[model samples]
Target: MTAIKPVIEGTDITSVEVGNTTLKLKQTVSLDSLQELISAVENFSKFFDLTSLGSADEGIKTEWNEQDLTQFLSKETREDQIVALKVLSDKGEVTREEFLNEMKKLLKNPGFRGWDLGGLLAGLSIRSRTWGYESPYIKEERREGNEWDTFYRIKERYAPLIKKWLKERGP
Candidate 1:
C-alpha cells in the first residue's frame, strides 16, 4: 500500500502544498474565514433539493409551506440561514429588503420559536458585504471587519506562493 499524506497538518499554523511551494496558513484564520463559506456551499446543495421538491411533485407543495418555513427557520444555524438567504436571493424569490421584512414578521410572531433573529440578521449583513449590499445595521470597517475581507486578505497573501507552486506544474 502507498503512503497517504495529509493536506494540512500543524498545531497553530497549517502547511499546505498546492503544487511544489508549501504555504503556511494560520489554522484559526483559515477556519474562521472560510468555514462558513465552505459549509454554506455544502449545505446549499441539500437546501436546493429540499426547495426543489416542491416543484418536483404536486404532493410535495406542502413541504415548502408555512410549517416547513417555520421549521427551517427554527432549526437552521447562522451559516445555514446565510446560505438559505443567498439561495433565495439568487432565485429572485426575495430581495434583501423582502428578506429583512419577512424576518421582522417572524420575529414578531410568538409562535415562531426559532434561532435568534439578531444573530441571523448580523450574519446575513456580514455575508452581504462581499457582494456589495449595504445595511444600516451592520458596517464592515477594515480588513478584519468581515469574513470575506479575511478570506480576501489570506488569498492575496498566499497568491504568490500558490502561483509559484502552480508554475512548477505545466499544462
Candidate 2:
C-alpha cells in the first residue's frame, strides 16, 4: 500500500501527495477557517440525499432535518460560541469579539457581529435561499464561486486540524 502524506510547506501553503497525484493549496488560515473546515468535514454526510440517488430503499436520505437545524442554531448562543472559539483557538485564549469577527467571515455574514438567535436564523435562511420564516436547512444548490472554492482550499489546508477537532468532539 502506498502511504499518502500531507505536508505544510509554509504558514500559508500545504501540499498532499497520494500515489501519482499531488495537491497544493495556499491560503492565510484563521481560526474561523479552521472551524468552518471542521464543521464541513464533520457534517459532510448530511450534504447529500443518497436515497434519491438510487432505489429509495437501497440508500438512506442524509439531508439535514429540523433536529439538526435546532442543534446547529443552539450553538449560536454566547456561551456556546465562546466554547467554539476556545476549541478553535491555538491556546484557548481568543476574545469573544475576535471570535465573533472570525465567525462573521466564516459565515460570510457581515452583520453576524450583532447576531442573536433570530439574526442567525434569518441569516442562515437567507443564505440557504429558503426565503420565508422557516427552519434553516441545507438546500440542493450547486457550490460555485470563489467563496466555495476558497472553502475547499481551506479545508484541504487544515485537514489535520479538522481531524483533531473531530477526534476531540467524538463520534
Model 1 lDDT tens row, 1-171: 111112322322233332333333333334343455334434644444322222112232121233333333344335435333433333333434344555556445433322454455556444434333322122221222221121101123323432333244222
Q: What is the TM-score of each candidate against the true structure?
A: 0.18, 0.21
Q: What RMSD does model 1 have? A: 20.1
After best superposition, candidate 2 residue 33: deviation in angstroms?
48
**Candidate 2: count of backbone clashes, pairs at least 3 residues apart or interchain:** 0
Q: What is the C-alpha lDDT of each candidate?
A: 0.35, 0.37
All candidates: CA RMSD in angstroms?
Answer: 20.1, 18.2
Evaluated at residue 106, the lDDT of candidate 2 is: 57
- Candidate 1: Cα lDDT at 110: 39
The reply for model 2, stretches above 4 Å from the true place, is: 1-91, 117-171
